[model samples]
Target: MQSFRTEIENPVVERDIIELEKKISLFRTGQIDEEKFRSLRLARGIYGQRQPGVQMIRIKLPYGKVTSEQLHRICKVSDEYSTGRLHITTRQDIQIHYVSLDRTPALWAELDKDDVTIREACGNTVRNITASETAGVDPREPFDVTPYADAAFRYMLRNPVGQEMGRKFKISFSSSEEDTALSYLHDLGFIAQIREENGTKVRGFKVLLGGGLGSQPRHADVVYEFLPTDQLIPFIEAVVRVFDRHGERAKRMKARMKFLISGIGLEAFMQLVEEEKTALPFKTYPIDHETYEKAQTLPNPPSVEVAEPTDESYLKWRKTNVFPQKQPGFYTLGIRVPLGDFRTDVARKLADLVKTYANNEIRFTLRQNIIIRDVKESLIAFFYQELKKLNMAAFGYNTTGDITACPGTDTCNLGIASSTGAAVVLEELIANEYPQYLYNSDLTIKISGCMNACGQHNMASIGFQGMSIKAGKLVLPALQVLLGGATLGGGQGIFADKVIKIPSKRGPEALRALLDDYEEHAQAEEAFHEYYQRLGQMYFYELLKPLSSTDNLAPYDFVDWGNEEEYVKAIGVGECAGVVIDLVATLLLEAEEKLSLAQESLAEKKWSDGIYHTYAAMVNAAKAILTSESINTNSYASIISSFDEHLVSSGKVSLGSTLSDIVYQIKTNEPTEAFAQNYLEDARRVFSGINAFREKEVNA
Candidate 1:
């Protein structure tokens, strides 16, 4: 790889890029294990695509906020390293595809120049911190969550406590009681709230814990009705610590925080979080929101004589795609990018438009669309004309006609069928046949390549999950139709029900049946989920079962969407959460690395960070030894106990105290400098003892 080390201004980021280059070199020369290298690259936002030798880089944009200059930088990187096309993800990040793995370091260096990042965009860390795109401007919001979200993202970006865990942790901040950010579906969700206390107003949040959507979805439990704003980051840190200690590791499917909390019960999980509070560095980490509250210097509205178009299409677009901000005389314009895919040429033009006319800021929505904020009311006509020139002024920004779908079989290894292909057909059907639904916000449609729900299929009113069905002697692509899902606001939601399965080619037909049935049904002015509940799941199943027939299958039905050949069921190992390799030598090496980090933190006088790093090092050493014994070490807590039972009790290794008492000290004592120093020494001793024992065994 060509050197671009001097391009990065931040020394820490510079080292990170250089380290990635070194690791890639090591992996290429067979010095680094593939699984270990996979984890390393994933933390930097390099993800494996279905196609080999090329990668998809996810550029992390906290709360979906992107400056025009940053967008231009992203487009430049896309053009230089990969295809000049960008895909906005449901998590509010941008992914560019088909780039050589060798160029990732340079790509990252380029993005960092504009203060953009891809760190923790993937892997078992805190993923992108998302919030309502209308956060600052939403009239219903008590306070803007942009500052709080940015603070959380900065704090957790490279925190040692969340560096590696059994599974990824997702966090969201909703703008208001409407819960537009979908707080209920996250691992740790905060809904902005405020209440009066003795004639003084104070900001806080309604906290939700442990919700997830997949093959089996769970609703998050309300842990607190109102947690003070200052305690938000501290509370989040405690929860992450507890999860890292107790979360499942052996069972990949059950490794999510939702499963762990459900297995242990929410009450017990809260107790664990409470227990970890003392180890936290802050009792109340106050965020500086005054800076964010400061008024931005927006562009002056240029005087123009052009009149607003009187066409029905423009009128409908105005009603649906334009929203008024809390700041009077300003509007936010939503641009519907179908399937979250757009060309770089259009992106550059959009960036220029926003920089010149709007607030120079654009936010990618959770529904995989873009919104330009703080546009003057007078410039609406001018902006619309400019956007129309770029072919980006399409109607139905986030309505029934705007379907959200993942890049299923097109790029994902776990994809069973072509979700993007199916989405195109369904969207076209809605545009041509169901134009009346364009203004309807009561129903939603989402599709995923598989049960993983990356496209958020389970949370939509009408959802489809990719699958396959065997008919007679042949296999064909299929979709699992889901219904009755909706968000009820205030941190509450319902996951869609799996109504029936049908051939992939019939996805559009199935949607047509559902919409047609709803249009002709008895109820007046009923929402889609409510209509489904009124009739029940069995009714929809029976209604769509006719389309599930495989008896009269055509030759085209055997082929998946967007394909010309016969369908083949080929599934690759997914790297969504990064793989875990239990190689004994690798684990020991990881233990040594953790000890070095612990020492570094102690030297820097970060007491709490040092103590946590020490705890991790001790646990890693224990897990390393237990892996050699072939014992089940599913969680860090289990690793501690199993180490005691299998090795410590057997007199094979000797620590001054039991491993639990030493490791669990983190939960008991405060993270004082004295404790941090003692903890680091303990970790070093434990790792040295384990290393000596392993060396003796190797020598024998």
Candidate 2:
């Protein structure tokens, strides 16, 4: 096996790589030309993930569909550039990882040849436009959203207005009620709907805006109950313009569309949207109706007709995993990709199977599962047989839901523990002890190796975050249990409240106990999040109190949560580096030249030393910003501006300031350290000013 260090030394000499690296070096030197920087960043796979080192490269598949040829291209990229795995994110985007600094541009060109792109996939610009994977094929859907999604994508792909925003923008479309598109969590979520008036079916969409997840999670608000599909592009453009002009830019965390909607009440926001829409050029162009029709026409699936009388094993698999499509004699089988991961071999085999038993149609679900739609009822048995052969036939849907986990300590630099490992254990426990739970209830058990919430733990009914605690003298793994998060019905989804912090070793048992409690106490037919909501915080606090012992926790305390049992697992040891400012500085510098100042100051140091220095700089910067602020009306921007001025004047960047600046500057102009410190000083200030603003109406 070749070492990563060796691979780094033996750089791939692709054309894009040379140009991309030059631009990256230029950006690092603070000599960034915005246009060039954008081009390079997009050209390369450098995306701003919730964490450092880890870059979320969005591989664009026009109309949310990919061919086996495209799939192979992606697989090659995954194996060559990333972790030999691909992640199908909720936004209908394929995210590859462990990408090197130099190989990105080459990867982009490789994808470009296949008509896929990563342009504007990240940055404070329009991200990959997403549509329902089953857009045209799902018969229950009112209309194929593929065209609409494509139109929106084309319109926004390089729109001058989308060049820079207060924060990154996400858009998604759901053609039906399956809600697989995760419309509620996007910055702008659109669901295709139809209205029949005077015996005419008018195409329209229910538009949602300002919903997202991170440290603060909020569900999008419906700005328009219904707007004609033809008007969607303009409507979306209007919303983008509104967000661009008025969205909070000084405070990165508070700059998301959700915060904007929360600040001005949703109704007022809607009124603003309506006002914007009226002023905008509402034009409809010629859509490729032929292409859309072709997409809608189900390709004849390969003939592998099975005899009647389904095998019992296949029947059980179908009963547990297959979802009935509105199409007669057709189904969408869920192939559980546990921990939202799969080997490249498995991916290749699955792609082959799709070409064979299915109609060469495969849909990747946000749950990290794959749906092979257009599978004829007769071929179900053969499909299961092939799936079992490939070791991809796990009947783990909705029971343990395959444990929606991020590539935690194994691959992410920001992860606190082995999230994937935790997920595997959790899924195993549920599968072995309470197999009935898989069928009887709809439970979402999500885990993030860290608090960045990449795993969407904050939105799960029962969420867990990996951390460490000091068990007297030794450090031990621990997990934070978050209760009452859900995203079921398109409203602002509530974040799970942290009720208990227990050892990672005890996570499975603790979860089982919690599930048992839920089963015992929940009202008949109540959903997990709903039942937890009715139970309230007190009941959960008391129920999990016994698991909160710190006897076997870690000793290192990176975050001051005031709990000796809770510590941030040190960075560098995890799969992905932890959120160390030095690492972020290096990445920022490598991505663009302007970040060279911070990079030069902190480069070539040991990870621990670099982190400590970064932390101190951030603290000093925050203090400077806060001290400079006018007590009465100091906005986030004012503090950040003050901090930047201080950094320039003093020629010193503190650890806290570095961390805070990166985080805060991403949204607002506020100094990151000041914002964080302010949150600590007055929890309500953080809540009312940002948290509550983002999550004002979410059911807690």
Candidate 3:
């Protein structure tokens, strides 16, 4: 038998309570080795998010399903080690924040005790497997995909081939027609399908491959109309193996499976998978259909005892947010969790409610939403009340579908602006200004702070990215708009074409104008994306000419910024920036509390005024670093330095400066920008350490 020690060889093992206490003492005494410290930190699930000092630890719930015990553990971990909050990701994963490196490993061990694994959560490997949360309960599903999802997860866990894929791989299974799994955008997508073979129903899947969305979005190709369920695992293994052998390993951007599918043509790739499948040395074990059936029949939900409701509000919710199940009088409720954010307390409450009303089950949707399956008619009222108390009773569904915003400047290291804050503001604007149209159209507006596209902006009906420009020696915040991307079922794809550029502050107005045009000119029953595409760019351009024009420019002179020679020909590449907080008083107070607890020295008297002043101070510091004689010596470093210099010369600081400061000024009199500069310097130091380490290993 394998020793339990071997099974827990990772930092999770060292994070045992006793070991953790010893490590904490070492860290407190400054005796910890830096490299080991970093490894242990990572092993414990603590990640240096996009912000300096603030960590985001991803808690992996295998198969996207967690027991009540696990949920409670997660809640406790977040409350004790993080920001007392949790974020439910689109991949059905949960992320907690503010965990320190010293506390990470212990937290992971705690999670391990509850059967959670955080391995490969962020690295260049197969990511969390996604499936229709309501897989077994939804009646519309031909077969439950939960078994397939679980089998795939076990088959791929720590598999050598998957340990180092060219890029992250995403796989999802949808057993229903509603497409709640967002299969169209995954690297690999499997949809349950059935066909009568000699009067017998044979279960299989329609396979999709290489679909992805970022700056260059593409829909998945339906390479195979049907593949037997038993052959599914081997077929997927073949596809991934092919990619492992031939996929580009040098160009990071071009390494995605989508690029491979595009380079090798769908027919050729499918042929290669078939050939490889024949020679594969392994086959997946048969699914235990009996066990699954028994699990499926565990218990029925309580029936509703009240009379059917006649209220329009409830009726609207039922129509838009509920999906029919194969079982009579049972339904799956799709609860929209706007922006994919929820508090830990709320999460616990939800877990309890699910236990009571949803047959002890819940599923997460790709849209950063949740679903309570097996809900009965009688329990609707109780479920409704609980959901309302948690502020999750909104019936938006596909109507005014919440803005999908990446954790831009707030936490991600690669943001150009505050995408989350911007999204919240834009959502509010839409709610207030266009309340009547909220339920009228299936419109999705997504925003990314930068081009990395964590928000999946490229696939939305409307999309925007944070940007900036130099205007008479001043850097002005701006946004780039994309239009007409909407994919219905099948492999039908539409790319979100660039429309115009405008001040970031004016995003709401721009959206309003675009929506107005859609409302006025759309043909009957036309989807917004379809309408925009059918109308062609010219008509919409003409309609939006007023908004596109610069101050004092005639309509004819207003050229689309996207079409400009510089933007058109320029390579769309940029580095990620560190995290930034909105400098509000409450946030400042929180920061102060953290600093005090850390026993860091700081002047707190002028905190309010100092915050605004920091922006300018950071700009100057950046200028000094960029113009330094040493920075100009290295060509690669010089390029980055020069860009910073340009921003500074234009009287601006790169937004990333907020998280890149080194030797942060703790005095309230010091500019907030100075602290940002210190953060940037710290980032450089870390990079230097990494480079030096790489060089030493190479020499050795």
Candidate 4:
């Protein structure tokens, strides 16, 4: 294996890259097991793709903020290590697909030069932190949530409590009550708020928790109607700590925070979080607003003869795709990049455009669009013309025509159908026939290749989740149509109701029928969600029932969109790396890895880190032993108790004390160097005992 070179000045980042390079070598040689290696790589934002022999690298961009330099760096990295295409995810992260696994360390090192990261962008860690793109410029926002969002991202990135979780956790910050960030469906959400108390104004947030969208979608509950801004990080850290201990692990489908809250009740979860306050590093984590409040605007460009746009299309574009900022004489332009798919060449052009005309920074939106801020009022037409050259000046920025979609069958392993394909079909349908709908902000159309809702289809006014329907003896590509979903503002939203299933070929027609019915029968100025509620689910079901027919289906019905070949049936149960692992050896290897980390932390005199590493080592070893006996190890909590019951009680293993007593010392003891050293030694002793028992079992 060749050594990867990194010029990163930070010791932490250099070590991280070196560790990844080392793990890649070990994994290639089969020295490290697949499951353990998967987790390690995922923490560094390396994810498996539908295509074999390659990876999908998610470049973490906090709040979707990207400077021109970073954008250029990303494009260069994409061209060098992957296909020359940049894919923007709904989470505000950029994904470059078909990257060689061996080149990832070098690719990461390149990105680091521009201060961009891929760390914690994938896997069961806290994913990228997202915020409303309009956060800083929103006229109605209490304050810019960018700094707060930035603080949250900084605190959680590689934080011990969030590094390895039961499942990926999502967080969001809404700029205003409009909740443009869609706080309703996040694991934890913060809505900017301010209140007058005794002649003084206080900054705070309306915090929502336990919300998620997947096979089962749940709206977040307001954990705090008003929580002081200073307490935000501490509260979230406590919650994450509680989740780390109690969240589900064995069942991937049931491992989200929503499931934990649903299973144990929100009150119980909150109580557990309250108990974790003692272990948190901070009682108050105040965000210094100056970090983002300093200067977010660029100087106005020099005077130029900007011709007035005479084209009717340009007028329509300005109406829907442009907005005035709270800052006087400035505006933000929304660039609708269809399906969030843009080539690297265009991305470089966009970077140059931003630097030349608008602010050097552009935000990738949650709607899978780009928002360019601080454009002078006079340069609107000029900006529009420049954007047109890149083929990105579409009229509907967040309207019905701008569909949000995940990279379905194109690259995602979990994709059941071609979401991007269906999205293109739907976009054309709207643009050609319903051009008037471009101004309709009340309507949202989203598509997901599967029920996981990566496309966030469940939260759209008209939603399509990828599915396949059995037609007699033949299986055909299909979509499950859902209706009535909408964000009601103030962190309130509705999850769409499932209406019916139809062939993917007829998705456009089904959409036509639904829109036509709403146009004909809805009351004056009726919102989509309101109209759906007024008319009820059964009404829309009957209207779309005609398109749901399987009779007299053509050959085209079996073939999905954006494919030349006939579509084979797919249930979207994409391959999981965990299931393919040799669980026993993988568990042992993970234990050894944790022990290594413990020693490294102790050597650095980091008591808390060393203690935590030791705790993780003990848990890992116990889990390996429990897995050997085929016991239920659903979570870290389960592993500890099961180790005592299946091994200690059975006399299959002994240390003269229960494994519970040995591990639980982490919670009771102070995180001093002496205690950390003792814990590390205990973990080493346990690892030896487990390995010796494994040897004896093999001999037998």
> How does each model score on lDDT?
0.90, 0.63, 0.62, 0.86
Rank the candidate models, highest lDDT first. Answer: 1, 4, 2, 3
TM-score of each: 0.99, 0.73, 0.72, 0.96
Candidate 1 lDDT by residue in tens digits, 1-700: 4658877899889878888898899899987789888888888899999998889899999999999999999999999999899999999999999999999999999999999998888888999999999998999999999999999999998898998898899999999999999999999999999989999999999999999998889999899999999999999999999889999988889999999998999889998888888788899999999977886555685577679989987898899999999989999999999999999999999998888878788999999999999998888888889889988899998999999999999998899998999999999999999998899887999999999999999999999999999999799999999999999999999999999999999988888889899989949878888899999989988999899888899998989988999999888778876448667787787788778877887888888888887888888888888878788989999999999898888888988778888888898889899999888888888888888888887888
Q: List candidate 1 stretches off by more than 4 Å.
A: 295-298
The segments of candidate 4 whose C-alpha lies over 4 angstroms from its true place after superposition are 1-6, 295-298, 570-582, 603-605, 669-675
lDDT at position 608, candidate 4: 70
Best by TM-score: 1
In candidate 2, clashing pairs total 45
Provide the lowest-lDDT 10-residue window in model 1.
295-304
Best by lDDT: 1
In terms of lDDT, the poorest run of 10 residues in model 3 is 575-584
* All-Cα superposition RMSD per candidate: 1.2, 13.1, 16.5, 2.0
**Deviation in Å, model 2, residue 580 alpha carbon:** 15
Candidate 4: give its CA RMSD in angstroms.
2.0
Write one digit per residue (lDDT tens) for candidate 3, span 1-700.
2133234554434434345456557656766654333333343334566555667887765456876667777888888888777777767888887777656656766667667777666555677898878778766788888888888887776454454445667898886656657678888988888989999998888888998877677788787788788877787777776665456544567777888889879888777676554335445446565586776754465555655556876776666777767777777787878778888889898888777667775666666777777777667766766677898877766565477776666666566655676678777887788765557547788888777677777777888886664444444456778888775754455668877776665667788888888778889989888898898877766665566434643322222222221211112212211111112222222233333322221143333223323322332233233333233311212333453455433543334343223222222223243553443344344333323433454477
Q: Which of 1 and 4 is the better model by lDDT?
A: 1
Looking at model 4, the pairs that clash are none
